[model samples]
Target: MGGPSGASGTAAAPERRSGLNRVSQQRAEAEERQRIAEGRHSDPFAYLGGPHGPSRRVRIYHPEAAAVAFSEGTEVPRVAGTDFFEAPLPEALEAPYQVCWRDAGGAWHTAYDPYAFPPVLSEFDLHLYAEGRHWHAQRFLGAHCTTVDGVAGVVFSVWAPNAERVSVVGDFNRWDGRRHPMRLRLEAGVWELFIPGVEPGALYKFELRGAGGCGPLLKTDPCGRRYQHRPETAAVVEPPEAYPWGDDAWMERRRREGSAWQQAPWSIYEVHLGSWQRDVGGGFLDYRTLAHELVDYVQRTGFTHIELLPITEHPLDDSWGYQATGYFAPTSRFGEPDAFRYFVDYCHRHGIGVILDWVPAHFPRDAWALARFDGTPLYEHADPRQGEHRDWGTLIFNFGRNEVRSFLLSSALYWLEAYHLDGLRVDAVASMLYLNYSREDGDWVPNIHGGNENLEAIAFLREVNTVTHGEQPGTCIIAEESTSWPQVTRPTYLGGLGFTMKWNMGWMHDTLTYLGEDPVHRRYHHDQLTFGLLYAFTENFVLPFSHDEVVHGKGSLLDRMPGDDWQRLANLRLLYAYQFTYPGKKLLFMGCEIGQRSEWDADATVDWAALSDPRHAGVQRLVSDLNALYRGVPALHRYDFAEAGFAWVDCHDAEQSVLSYLRRGDAGEQALVVLNFTPVPRHGHRLGVPAPGRWTERMNTDSAYYGGSDLGNAGGVLAEPVPWSGYPYSVTLTLPPLAGLVLVGEGA
Candidate 1:
């Protein structure tokens, strides 16, 4: 009787413990559902959907639905206190089962549960990304419309290592962050999710919840291939379609002539696409229209290449695409990515190379863009000294970070590979090279070696140049470097930054200053024009009259000349003639060719009406002839970077305000250039000739064809055997007022 009582008590104790365990499990489930409802659940996939427990029950969460069920007509029972419904796994349901829900409007919609799919990113991809060696990071990071396990959907990925939860939110899900939370890849800092039924053209952004009470940061895709037009920061899903390239011949030719661009003639027409021309309504023209119009204009002008001022996607029109927001996406202000492709393709087909002004120096501090992404300084450095450009009010990229390098490098290659651009002219390189650029002594942080040089940025530059050139042969990477940075255009293997060319800022400044002086005082400042030759061949240089020269209260090139109207036009012609004959490649802004009277305004088109004036038309014609001559003559362009190509015939004639030089080609071809800086004519000027022959006027800036006074050497001049100015022969010829001459020898 006693033993039976003891056994009953023990059984009662076991029953009580089981009851408590059931209550604890129920409470934990309730808490988990609460986190999911609040959008704070880090791993919603573990408990939200899929077969769980011995009963194989499937759970679904739909905040906007009135009722939920499986596609096979299996009704799911809603939990009493939550927006979740649960039902046992259906036998007839497929692997990616569909969940049908009735909305509050009594409309039924069926969608494949986004959380049902497995991880879309491969292990190798994660490994490479974490190691920061993902050269093609774009192939894995952006929203790609692809087929995963025979199910059509978009695989969205982003690098947000500090995020506790990241979601793919857009208008499809009512912009709710809780609708489709992504699964985090622990190995790498990337988050990825495959959302079925999401198609191309869907607008999306990453909604992130950071740790330590940071934020619910909503950010545009960093690697977005296409974004919506400005004033709206959402990224659009671009279809994964390869552009039909028709530049096979161009590509092959570029590859065959790799690194030979130095010897080639580069008469670049630097154009600001937005202001180069506009629609009749004064609005922006689509890329397709620009393709036909701009290409035709550049071709007719005889420019070998067109250097476009930054067309990368940016928000503010005032930034002129320099403060870039999207690196991979072409600015939608024109057209879709495919349309920009048409523009480049059209250019190449017409034998015109296109170079884009690429800005990797700094980025704008837009909230939806890269600034403080993941509620932390992810893409930029946290320290203000190293991370910020105070003058620009922009953030500098942390080149010291490996992932940042991957991002920037991938961006560079994407343009070359996807758009088939001829090259990139990197903007504001001086700022990137110096740690104290635009900074006070106490405001900037020095390097570990207490130096002003930014070693990390230097390394990044070298790496980018090496990677881009190695990947895309014949891609001419130029630097707009203003300072005396050494070896910017040399090979990286030789401890150089490895750019193809650099803009000659010193030449531009010195020549402009000299030309701005009056003729009466020109002899006192003659050295300004001759001083550039001292270091002219230090690097492969591009003589640029860029947009910088025609903006910010600095009037047009024509306005720089100090003379009467007639002499001003002649001086403008002389300027172009000097630039073409100079030992460098050429880059002239769009309006400069026609002698634009007003400064460059990004909001306005080039003053096409100026072309109606004969004086302006004359300048334009002179430019075209200069391009033709620069390309046709070997002596003028072949050895532009070699010391053997140029010789001072009579640089000592400063008292007469006259200068002369001899340009020599490798094959003994020769051209003599002589300029009279003053407005007075220098007739009977005994200029020394390199050879004893007839020197014909190839280009006379004072010719009547160029709005000049028709004062120059009559058709040709014969050099006598009289040694003068340390030459074997001499020619006495008429030098025009405020003009220059290009005299070619008969044998040349």
Candidate 2:
């Protein structure tokens, strides 16, 4: 029998539901339609899809149709004045079927019903996520397009465990939460839904309802791989398979290194993407343009790697990407996610490694973001003392929570695995280590053991290192830790943070301060230059002169010098020689190479105009030469973090403001380094040598080619038999004023 049609219907299908059974099913169908219309259905899918019973009775709730029918089943009954429609089918729904519908204006439309598909997330996925060990959550818990039952749509999922209800609101559905509510996976605290007809480039956010007094909270997806451009903070749908990479050689080299970057001569050029370069119109350059421009610049500059300042998605340009919101999404300030991947791939293909500054210590308190997520402090602690960063007015992650721990760990692995990045430079680790960081008395809390250490964050750091180092063999994890945290670079089994390297913050401060003093007054502060050696080999260190030294009114590296034009340039040149020849790795911020005279500006580009000046150009040239020397000369880099690499020859030469040192490699090569701080040259200075041989001057900071006065040794010095300064032999040579020199022993 044919089913009823509109207001004039024939008898129902053969042996159809009748009497009390018919009335009961009608009531249940009416209730299901009401729930769908109210956007509060607990199990909408249980009643909306085909083949509901033994008689193959099917049902569907299209809240916008005046008349409807299926291609294979009987004409569905309208079930009174509501959108509730039903019919009886002869077979089960094995494949996708189109729904023919007519609107109030009498226009026909068709679409695949979303409920016909099965659940996408697997049980194993739910178990791993519940255990807080899902290191690749982004692969499963975000909007991704796929085919289900021969139908294409986007699968939207998010973690909102405390929400009474959750829905995906986007442009395709009029941004109305009343249209589509997601299914809740109770164990994993995740909500998911597959919506038909949603395509790429669609903008969306999660609208969550909780029991709290606050209204529905619309949040940007924490695991979104791509995002819409700023001034609009919505998650944009993009496919991860969009970008194809070509850097297998570089990746294989890293696989060979396997956490042994301590002696790899990593001379990193630190840059902020928004200000590294600007277009002719004064706007930010796209990542593709930067891929060409920056790769050429870094390769010619001889830097082994480039470390970007937090290119993750951020709202304010002033934060310099430190206050990032989208952990999985790259910053849209430059280009799309795929373009940024291309930038990294280009660098790798050209033999340049890429490292990103990752910030997990804090997040901004923006209303539309992670703060009060799900109408509560879902990602942060409820207490201000534990959750808030007082100085920045941002929220701190509650690392004690299992889900929060999993989210952060997943983000770390996602970058290395998905983007093919070389490493992560973790920012503000000191802040995350101590509870009293940037806090006044009585404004903080102690840990479970009544100590000021952040135990939970410490555990999280150790776990992150253990997981990343164990999983990604060749990749490195660096910490910007300022305090005397022991074993920071040691393995996790030895009760350490398990980082590969730690920034030598003390060396940066002391060395820069010593170099800024007047030559006449440098004798009194000679310890500033020698104190760093007291703990130089404590951890695998990266001697950094990063952006911190040149911003917020501290002035540029050039401005920090205290001398006339010639003296200042020479002093700056000598500083570079000291940093490169010293035991440890190296990192220099952008614009410092060209002798930028002012502090760093996040809004403006680097001082490319400064290169027109010969003095500035000379500084840039010297830095490039230093990089080449650092990598080529094993004595300058190998065994950098071991006691066998360095020795002080003349630390007590305070009267002349002079210093001498020896740098050695594992293969027994030797390089002698000497620095003269005063403006007066030392003629016929007797220097002790450990071996009786001729030593050639390898580099001289006072050479005329580097914009200096051209003072140097004639070419090489011969060691005589006379014993002096604790060595078996001595040599007499002229030491240039306000300059540095490196000498390699014969046969080295």
Candidate 3:
């Protein structure tokens, strides 16, 4: 009885253990499939699409497919109740063996398994990115077309340090995050993956999971080179390609003549591409069409440079690109990035410099953008006081972070290098400089020294200026700084901000205030006209009548002139003349040239139809002539940034409401500029001059050609040997009503 029981018991015990083992293995496989399906697997490469376990089985997850097989006709069996398909690796096949699959509708397709490829980012790249010293991080971080093992595809990389898992989601995978999870490079906190057959034009984004279970945040690529137009926020893959640039002569000249543009006449025509002009339907003109039309117009107007408002990709048209989302991308509203490159090339070919308005001050809080990137305050400051811009309803960049600095500095250099742009007019510099910008006492954070300055932002600016100028020699870095920031345009090595020039906002405000006053009362506020000269040469300056001057109920520059229509037009002419003859470079917004009556509108085109009126056309003519005169006469432009080139002939004539000045050139070339602010003409006004020779009237804003009364000096006037207004010689001439006159001396 004991022997019979022993054999039966032993067999039963062995069967029981085998069955339990099978059950445990089945449960573990199910859990693995579930994690992959849910896109929660931190390392998809460790589990799928590649050989794994002792069996070296290849795994695939295709939920929509009815059947899956290897390209060599090896069928893959799906684990029951799961999308996980698996088969032992065929000895004849390689790691990247193509997987053929038939969809539920029985249509077959083939593609290499994405997880089979190893990490694409180099170790050196990861190190530099981690240190925030990679000036060209975009080259590796964004979706780039590259070949791995001789197979062509797009490699996508992104920085998401706080993300526990990140997946490349796009149309190719039917927007399923589980289809292609990326591998994390631990050193740099970057996620990277290369998917074979993904080409340019594929729409993509990153689906991320936060480490603290915070998100499944779907964010567009930060270094996206092009994005969908507003209302759709997917980043498009635009691989780098060689643009056939024909501006070698222009680029060579720029490289050769470093700093010459400072002394050269700079009549910049500021334009908002959207509203500068429009098609018949009032929609935006593509960059190609704009290239021809805009370049021709700027050339005809004799503007030496065209300063465009920000063209960086933005979600809202009304923001005018200041609230930017895609820093590296040109707005798709104007066509592709290459078309914009063509626009810049066309300008350079025509001898016109293109300056882009770049905004690094802050970024809008779009859910799919940089705000709370990686489900943390990664790109922005964690504290609202330091991170948020209440006035703009935006988030300020964490300039203290090295990665953020690299991101912004890369963007600045990207525009200059990619598009061959001549300069960058940095927007909202004052906001970036001050910690208490648009904030109350407790709402802001002060620097270590208890100062209001943003020291981190200052350092970032200096680095940007230094790098940009060093990398792109001869390219200008202009700051739209409104405050009396010391040494904004001075050299960084000399403990300054190192900007090529700063906007003369003080002069703009003072002159506009003075010109807005009634003619009879202008004498009382005459200091506004003369006070700027006290510090005109303190920094290199660009006297800008920018878009800010013509918006927010301020009205157009012409509307600011307080007088009858006739007197207003005359005053407008006088304003332009003064700006041109002033001791600084010049910037005029688009509609201001034709004397647009309405405030600048981003949604509407400039009032080009206003040119039909003689007065408006006359203002346009005056602007052209002013540009020509400013360029041709050495006396006007040769010493724009130096004190030795300018002297007041008669700034104390507040009684007559008249001002006179002298612009001197290197070789004793001198020009006299006189402005009569009153509406009444002075028949016998004596203006002091530095020279005693014949002074030819180069430009008279009162001439009939400019819709004026045509009252001025009779072609030429001889200066008498009489001391007047602290000068060695004086010229008694008829001064035009509410006009400006520029007369050049004939000989030394």
Candidate 4:
């Protein structure tokens, strides 16, 4: 053993040398620190605070010699003659403090750590109950809860100014109202409970035991469209994960195909899918049926896109879906959420883009899912002055709230991301952007400078555009605002809410009012048709014959015309042709292409029998041909606002009106549009042209295909450079009265 120890000692000699080297290194570091201090090499701020030092400082502002304070487990002294009361925070000399309280029995009862009450709850109605009071009898107006750390707890609060007691009853407590009562906190005239059992999808409601008996169970989630039980009973919906998208490749393909929505030549066919087609017995048309029939119909009708009315869930049977309840869920009445996905998928597959009609301005009260959610005006404005929408008898949302803003932004993204919708047609955008949008001075809220402009709502709209376009670049947002809000289609960063297109309401009203007049009187209104171009650049616009024009005692387009059946049809054809050739995009309501003669009635089906007639059939065919022409001619679909894309040939006379314009493109690609407003046909009309050569009639409203007099140029190039013409070239041709013609320059 001694010999082995001697050998081990010999082997440990090198290890001892290593240890001595470490000690020597430590001694040298100490000596170097001392030398640096002597030479003043160390900075005073070096150890004060840095990445390697303590980032912050702690200091006591005041210190007392001695003070009695309640410990964590100390029992709060119960005061007599008080059912609802608040316990004061333990403090001296107005210093910040914490409160700890326990029941008479030993337990970790209640504790408020470093409490600083918020002021936003000043206007809210709230109360607190003592631990021994009838907590079961308390009635809660609304309660909001969120998680802290890993424990699921709710900071329960309610608004019941008249209630003596309020307590939460839910599945977690087995519906027992008394056992799990809300503890009254420090706030007076308010009740609060820090409960740890409530979680997502847990069915709960406040049992309001008032001065009389228990009040009705009131639910939360006022903006919800679908509810399980009663109006006051809110359903605990399991938040749905974003749908797994299968159309990334399809989306990329569409991006490469160059959508009409992105192009200026956009022409949309506005549709109400439910009424566009129906069964023989007038039952609901399934989504698949609508997808197959409506998608093909839109494609064949020559429309570049299809804009649908609101497809969100609604309570009313015949609603246009404007009163949306389920912002996240598609209408289950039509089919599952996947059905809407398929419908959009079909449109994309068929080379047509789909646009959803989104309503975000206000919400209906009928939806228990959304109205008074959280038993208060949580989703809507807390103040009635800012929250109420008197025109529609609805509740306007508080766009200023971050959570509400996120909710709406997420809803829009859901459609664009999940359903593969190419765009959105925002309904009632005017109402969303103005405090006095549809109200008088007394009925609205004023801005900071006492103005009516809803700056918050406008800011929210900008945020919506930023979020939407930021997430998906090509997705278009179309505004259905009627007000003269300028630069709506401009970029959000430029003090404008970014919309891709806006409804041309001025054009629709002017054109419709003009068409209602006699042909003799129509000359005076001819400027109305062309006058829209002056303001066209304010925002990219879509000329729409929407449901608003056809519903609510407003007659159909055919009925609004000023003549007999044949003349009415001719006027309609002319109107359609003019709309197609106009400066902006076009959107026609369902059945309008084939001349539905009646107003749109939600209870009844579309007058499909109208299309059975040969004249109507011809109209449909003309529509098909028009779409084909639009797609074939790059000049018709190119940059519409550029000088190369538009040129006015004539717009002088109010009587015997005749306006001619040219839609020109790069490389001599052009289409000359001539519109005759007179009721009588004129032979050899000297129509002006840009180039002095030959021109051929490309599309004519007077053609037999669209039930016209067949007074059209038979695809023949006519010699130009006629005598006494202002333009470089002019061609003499017969033009039918109340007709529109598109003449293609030869080889253009």
Candidate 5:
């Protein structure tokens, strides 16, 4: 064996060189090998299974597999030093076939081939999605069950245009992203994949690699209809709209009376579902149970609609669903998504509309949520000045992005179409319309024209309003815009925001401040009580004493009054009377009626035991009667946004701490509302009436039935021929201390 060079091993050099070449080839294949190992491959479908040399070739990636076999009489060869098992077929493979794996235990297993399916999303959907016109984007993007090529599976899709790669990782594949890298649809920047053997109730998450150098992001589906209980961030797969709706008659009525919502009585009872009477065990009440309990209460209490605080899925209990992570899902804290559907259905069946509080201004920047979604500010702006909400520690949406606008727009329509919601009370609308909202100098960025107005957000709002109203004829879109935005309730054709109504925030702030003052000092702020009527019909307004007035150390509505216990209750009664008789829609928070003494705590339930006290019970009774009277009397709600409906009888009585007004409705219906702020009843207080013979005392805040001093007005008052307050006829009556009274003409 020795050569002429004295056995220097030169004779076996060719074999050594050949081994070195194989090592070099294997080293280059390591990237292809490691991608299969780590699940970060961009195009898994293209490489995993494809046509090789005019015949079909397949790769089965199972690290634990001992041997791999196809059902079509083809045996796959396992690659040495890798988990991949590959095979070259003599003919093309028919889909819906099975793959058998013999694991280390020597037992055989079978499952359908995941690669046998076609694309779940169509190309036309991509075109609409790119233009921000896909109102039903939720139906296409979220996880859905379908059959492709005779193979039944779950199709997973998401919009992650800026991601390098996205994968569906879950318990089925041992949380491995490399196992199911989704195929990217480049036109819409959406990634989708169909996996066989995945069924409903499976927990899943997206494992996404960002376009730049950054860590991967694990996120819940934004359009997920259901989620696991909190502290578990995985999205639960479920079929949509499985609940059988029983509101056909209600929907038919809405179609027939298309414009009834505009002229109807809208006394909304705003409630926080978590804190509004919890279960006996101190847990949250199920949506189904609340459907029955809340429905009966709203029906009996005479509230036309129940406006719920945001029920969208959120991580923290303290946020009360405002910092929502799941825009489409109903929080599982109460019940399943179907249960929430039942809640809406029950409201509709019983003649009560449900208005959900929708928040699109900003979202919490939790690691598992939409913040830096693709690890590169995909959902938000890259600049902190434009994206971050410093006040709330949240992230503002980049409305300039078409996909982002489409996402939010789709959410608004989804509720009205899927859940049958009558309206959406868009929360914090002022924050959305202003680029400098709650910001100091140099802390925010200006728009394209260097102004404070968020132009893109304005355009988005117009689009949402136009589409929602166009699609749903009778649907209402109320805006909780605290600022005096111009023409919020006007149509978009007139260059307005096109809202159904805007909350009268100035009225709420001024009146609450005035009520908090001592009665002796109330005379100085008499203008505060009368200033709202100056521009009362500026926009279709809603006089709301909402949850914001009773939280965050502001104190409860009853606690806001500056008086002794009796005076406080009396002031609250008078306040309620004025609100009901005011010329606008009405919304009252839950505990305001029963007089909850403390600020609202989202964690705790209402103090139901307070009802044992007669004072609290009386306030509750008064609210019920107010709603009933407001509904039965046309003068209270008819032509609420018109100038002819109201007139100031006396706006300059600051010395006496008194104000009086007259309201007129269609059909010559009329009423007089008078209020005395001080705790001093006035005997024979003369006020003018339009044309009166006998005036029946409709409601008195000082009635003995409402825990007030039964002051001196005996049921009715007759007008005298004496001229008073610039009118031909005047009614002389007693005005109760710290009270409001409404009187209707018996014969005008």
Candidate 6:
């Protein structure tokens, strides 16, 4: 019996091995047959036609098409379905006909052999539905790429159930819609393409051919944080990874200092690199120059962080980068993508964390790229009613698709991983969160009664936060949300869209309005300054003088002060002091530190010369000293979220226009902040203190360095203790009019 069993086992093993070999051979033959049938178009890597050089991959949209070659700088002869025949690199023409194809409409398109030109997809539109089956009875949906080619390359997919045909068009095919038709794939109603040669810098869109010729152009990545124009758009740069980064050492040192971004007291200096300091000859400054000059300026300014506006490419000359076209490419106007990488690397090298201003709210309407890509609304909402953003005249994205979600999440990761950005300040959070936020009732669809929250967008935001914070520990995500959305700074897993911080829009509006008012009127608006404490616990906050408040006719912060030049200076000084000592993080506009007298204009450079004036000198001094004081006081920087960090000492002296508060910690560390809004100095004023013995004026807004009179008492005394009052001590002090005082107690 044993001998029979062994024989049977040996025979079975041989039979099994033979069967496996046959299966493998059949599979190989099948694959080869499929390749021939597909006409080598599907395998972009094979059949290289250009001169023997570096064996690089190329993407040919139609391999079945023929090529009509022409001389250098000359247009090719028009064939039946030929859009254009060209090579990605000029040198590839030496041995042409390497890679060629016929597009979906039988258009002849060709590229060089190994290094074929990257296919460009553009002009995408989207149509969303409340349900999959209905057309006229459905709601418009926004579209965005959630993933790209399994890895992430700005995946271009859309949902348009009503449309009969869809094609992506843009600079890839010279905006020829017929040359690059998107193939509809799967039961999920997604159109897909795996154009391997396409890399960052290629401008593209989708073309949707339905009942009519084609619909309007749409912005594919409406909320893309970075973008450039098409045709004339920034080149698709394959950046060589090379940099002798001193930042790893810096990051390690910072970690040793417990200086992971979360541990530091964030005082951000918001900057627009293009206009912050432009070249005198009418061109933008290069990244290296900006790194040297701008980085130095931020470091000297005593800010802990630098928050940059969108460095992404946009089409218009003066667009604040609100209308993005190239989602992955950095603006060529500022230099190449690697140059931007160098700039961020420099910031990290200097012990400074960089925060990028990201906009994923809406996209601009540009026909050459993104808009109506695939000849349909594949990257945006198809229904004009839902896909369009009326206020900005841009296209809104559909965030409901898994691919779209992956696309955005990957973008956030790209910045963090590639650029080493410490954080992201999401712009237009309010707009992204609501479907009918800025739209009229008839123009928008409500999720529920009186509710317009874009549920898909909310989901996107939640995913973004989850993926970003989860992947990069200690990296912050701040929201520029103006609406009173509950728990904007809460964690995503807890039923809230996680953000480390939210801009204190209430504080900014209240403070600006109050500061703009006359002294007599400020008494009534004191609550405006103090009312923020009521909701401080909801989220971490930042006091910002961002680009928004200084644009248009709003005027500069200095211009908004309520008095003459001197009083204006003093008011500004007082305001700055208050901002630093306020119970949250702080951010200042580029020129506000040195007191730029005019409103911000994207086309103009900041008034760097304003620092020469003594009036403005005071503002600069106060800013520098405030930075020092903020760093010195543990109470100011420790546990900002705790209630124990802030306490109202006095709000009763409305007639005298005085307010006092204390920022303290559990370790007997305390800072007393006093403000006098009146125009005249008050001598021997009684000020309340939590614990008083001998109080020394650590910082005075009216100090000589700050270009103010030395009317402040150098050393003040706090003698009386009142049990009836909540404070443990009180002081009789001299308060200067239109000035602020920061007094620290003698050791313990």
Quick one: best lDDT, which candidate? 3
lDDT scores in order: 0.90, 0.85, 0.92, 0.65, 0.87, 0.67
Candidate 2 Cα RMSD after full superposition onto the native fold (Å): 5.4
- lDDT, candidate 1, equals 0.90
Provide backbone clash counts, one per model: 0, 0, 0, 25, 1, 75
The Cα RMSD of model 6 versus the native structure comes to: 12.4
Tens-place lDDT digits, model 3, residues 1-748: 7888998998899799999999998887778788878878777887787877778799899888889998999999987777889999787888777999998888999999887777889999888777768888899998999999878999999998889889999998888998888998888889999999999999999999877866789999999999998889999999776889999999999989998888899989999999999999989999999999999999999999999999999999989999999999999999999999999999999899999999999999998999988989999999999999998899999999888988999999999999999999999999999999989989998999999999999999999999999999999999999999899999999999999999999999999999999999999999999999988998999999999999999999999998889999999999999999999999999999999999999999999899999989999999999999999999999999999889988889999899999999988899999999999899888877878889999989999899999998889799999988788889988889999999999752
Q: What tens digits encode model 1's per-residue C-alpha lDDT throughout 225-255? A: 8998889989999998688989999999999
Model 6 regions lying over 4 Å from their true place: 1-231, 234-244, 250-263, 448-450, 716-724
TM-score to native of every candidate shown: 0.98, 0.93, 0.96, 0.72, 0.95, 0.76
TM-score of candidate 2 against the unseen true structure? 0.93
Model number with the top TM-score: 1
RMSD of 5: 4.0
TM-score of 6: 0.76
- Model 1 compared with the native: what TM-score? 0.98
Q: lDDT by residue for model 6 over 357-437, one digit each (tens)? A: 887777777775555654556567887766888878888776775545644565677777667788889989998888878
Pairs with steric clashes in candidate 1: none
Model 5 spans > 4 angstroms off? 1-30, 90-92
Model 1 lDDT-worst window of ten: 126-135
Instruction: For candidate 2, list the clashing residue pairs, or say none.
Output: none
User: For candidate 4, lDDT tens digit of each residue in 636-675?
Assistant: 7675544447878777656678878878777888888888
lDDT (Cα) of model 3:
0.92
The residue-level lDDT of candidate 4 at 89 comes to 29
State the displacement of the C-alpha of residue 104, model 4, in Å, after optimal TM-score superposition. 36
lDDT score, candidate 5, position 725: 80
| lDDT for each residue of candidate 5 in 453-541, tens digit (9 for 90 to 100) | 99999999989999998898788899999988899999999999988889999999999999999999988999898889888888999
Residue 249 lDDT, candidate 5, scale 0-100? 97
Write the number of the candidate with greater TM-score, choosing between 2 and 5. Answer: 5
